[model samples]
Target: MAWTTIIPATALHDLIGQGAPVLVLDCEFDLGDPARGRSVYRAGHIPGARYVHLDDDMSARPDGSNGRHPLPDPAALAARLRALGLHRGQQVVAYDGNGGFYAARLWWMLRWLGHEAVAVLDGGRQAWLAEGFVLESDDPAPVAEGDFTIAPALVGGVVSADEVLANIARGDLLVVDARDPARFAGAPHPLDTVSGHIPGARNRFLRDNFDATGKFKLPAELAREFAMVLGETPPDKAVMQCGSGVTACANALAMEIAGLKGAKLYPGSWSEWTSDPARPVATGQA
Candidate 1:
């Protein structure tokens, strides 16, 4: 599948060990201080891993309050992929230092542009280290650029503020907030201007989707956990959100691993949603 959350370490190790035509990308990013992720990547990262800083590379300038993390131009992204030797049919593995904050973004973006052979590293680099996988500061082996084509983006996969505004009472579609407990509970948000969430949105911190070690829980484990919350709500109808739309992708990515489908992103999230006073805000817990 194009949107797998966890790939096997043994499989990756064997492929990497034998020098396969695979590319590994390190997507370490800290939302509190974006530059901090680059510093960590510079100090030492998974050997042969190319760093993709979230601010500088992954995210474009916020397009007003309605479009945070707007998709970068496909041609520009293709150029970067070419430099990284990510061509069509090439397997790409992405990982973040903690959980999959930024890695999931790259993975989903790649799939959005029609590249299917990409996945987020399970348990992240920490798990690899714990499993005795080798680490190196040197860059990865050079790869021959394959033919990667850019298809038109499926814009329907993205939810808009207008959609939320119009469908506040629609019971068929559910909006999921993937921020921390404090932020989701509207207790003085840390990043957004307002300290509230979208009315009718459900809270599921992105952190809950992972284990204490920052690795994703087993697929079965995740399925049971989400089932308790989702009940009979098919995952496909879920729309994910968070501050500025980063961690929400983590939740969206986890759903794919759990065999649920659709679950698109509300990229503007609370940051854009609350930028204007005209939008309705829901405060406090449900």
Candidate 2:
């Protein structure tokens, strides 16, 4: 079976043992210290796992108008993925220490490029370590170039700033912000110039998707919780966003795990929303 949403450490371990064609990626990152991700990867990582950088690999160079961590150009990203040993049908597992926050970005990007075999490792690097798996500090051997090709996306599509702006007037879409409550509540943001969220957006912090163990809540539980948040709106009509569009993927992943699919991602999100002074920004709770 193809693991698309979240995969447990034990299952990943067994998957490796079975000698399937898999590509494991270590996506650990720190927003504050950007260099720390590669540093940590060199210190230790899942054996045979290659490291992917948030800024260098996953995002494009952002201008003033585009949000921080703008989505990488599709063609450029496809080439990088090919070099990273990502074949079309290979099982790709991504993991990060901070819940699935960083890894989910890669997971979402892969899906955006029409790769359905990608999944975020449940509970991330900590889970692997907790399960008695030893991490290797040695650099992985060079891999043969892969033949992964980009195709029409198999999952949800990207929502544009224009669509989100028009939605404010249409009121047909449910825009959910996945940043922390404080950031959603108009607290002075450290990253972006504007603090508040979109005019009609509701706050659904990505952390809420996880339990005490940092693993995602059960599918039924997530479904119920999202039902309350979504009200009468269906998943297909919802739009997920965050500060720079990273954490938003975690929410989308949660919705998918809850069997509520088709929520589109706003890759530019609030960072792009606030770039233009004319766009409306609403403070306080929705």
Candidate 3:
């Protein structure tokens, strides 16, 4: 079976040593300095791990309306993956410096493209380093290009700002924001010009999904925690969002790991929602 949601550091080490057909991607990124991720990768990274830039590879240029990190074009993403040596049935593991926030974005992107053999490294590079794994400064030689193709349809696991607005008006879908409490409460708008969350959206900070050591909490604990937020709403009817649709994937991944599937992502998120002057914004908690 494919490793779909999350993988541990030891398991990944074994996979690499055993020469398993796995593609390791270093997704370390600094939101303030976009170029810092590649530089960090150049200094040292996991053996045979290719670096994926959040802005260049994982997202498209913002058109001033599609939020800060718009989803990349499917065909372009497929080409990039093929160039990176991703192939059918190859397990892909992505990791970041900051927990699994950015890494989970790549995991969600692969699943959005209909590839199931992808996962985020739990606790990310921090976990690997803590486990005394070796790091390599040299970049891997390019491998033979693979024949990875984009799926015909986007299928599921995504929602647009329009859909969110419609849902809000209908009062049926439950929208969850994964940003910090202060940001969700409309104070200290650091990233975007907006200072609040979407009206009717509940705050569920992503960091709460992890433990003190930054590792994800046990599955049962996660399930119970999310159960509080979900209440009577079914998982399939819930939507997750964050500042720029980045960290929100962390919540989606956690939900899947907790066996609560079918929650969709709002890729346009608050960035896109606030770009318009007409959308309602809420503050001071849910």
Candidate 4:
């Protein structure tokens, strides 16, 4: 079966042991210290897991207006995935120290690229450690060339900043900001110059999707929580965003796990939304 949403550490262990064709990725990252991702990956990671850099591999260089972590060119990102040994049919298990924050970005990207076999490691590295899985410090062996290519998206793709702006006036789309409550409340954030959110967007702190154990909440629980925010809007009518579009994917992932699929992502998110001074920004509670 394709592991589309999230996979437990024990399940991943069994999959690896079965010698299935898989690409395990370590997506641990720190927004403050960019190099720390690779540093920690080199220190220790899942055996045979390759490292994926958010800034270098998953995103394009920021051009002042394209947000902090702009989505990379699809073809370029496909080529990078191929280089990382992700083939058309291979299963991808992505993990991170952060509660699937960075890992879910890769999961969403793969789904957007039409690969349905990608999953984020539930509970991340801590779960793996708790399961008594030994991490390896040695460098992983080089992988053979992969034939992965981009296909039509299997999940909701992206919604542009223009669409989001128009939605503010249209009052048709549901915009959900996945940043923390404080950040969503227009608190000063070091990552972005602007402090507010899209005029009609609602705050849904991504961390709230998790339980006390750092694992995702059960599907039924997630459904009830999102129901309070969604009201009568269908999942397809919603757009998810965060400071720079990273954590937004986590919210999107949670929605999928809640069986509330089809919510599109605002790739530029708050960063891109705030780039233009002309765009309206709303501060305080929604």
- lDDT of each prediction vs. the true structure? 0.78, 0.92, 0.90, 0.92
Q: For candidate 4, write residues 84-143 as lDDT tens digits.
A: 888898899999998999999999999999898999999999999999998999998998
Which residue pairs does candidate 3 place in steric collision?
none
TM-score: model 3 vs. ground truth: 0.97
Candidate 2 lowest-lDDT run of ten: 151-160
> Which regions of candidate 2 deviate over 4 angstroms?
none
Measure candidate 2: CA RMSD. 0.9
**TM-score preference between candidates 1 and 3, better one:** 3
Clashes of 3: 0
> Sorted on TM-score, highest at the top, how do the candidates line up?
4, 2, 3, 1
TM-score on alpha carbons, each prediction: 0.90, 0.98, 0.97, 0.98
For each of the candidates, the C-alpha root-mean-square deviation to the true structure, in angstroms, is 2.4, 0.9, 1.3, 0.8
10 residues in a row with least lDDT, candidate 4 = 154-163
Error of 3 at 136 (Å): 0.3
Tens-digit per-residue lDDT, 215-247, candidate 3: 989889999999999989899888989999999
Assess the local accuracy of residue 132 in candidate 2 as a C-alpha lDDT between 0 and 100. 97
Q: RMSD of model 1, in Å?
A: 2.4
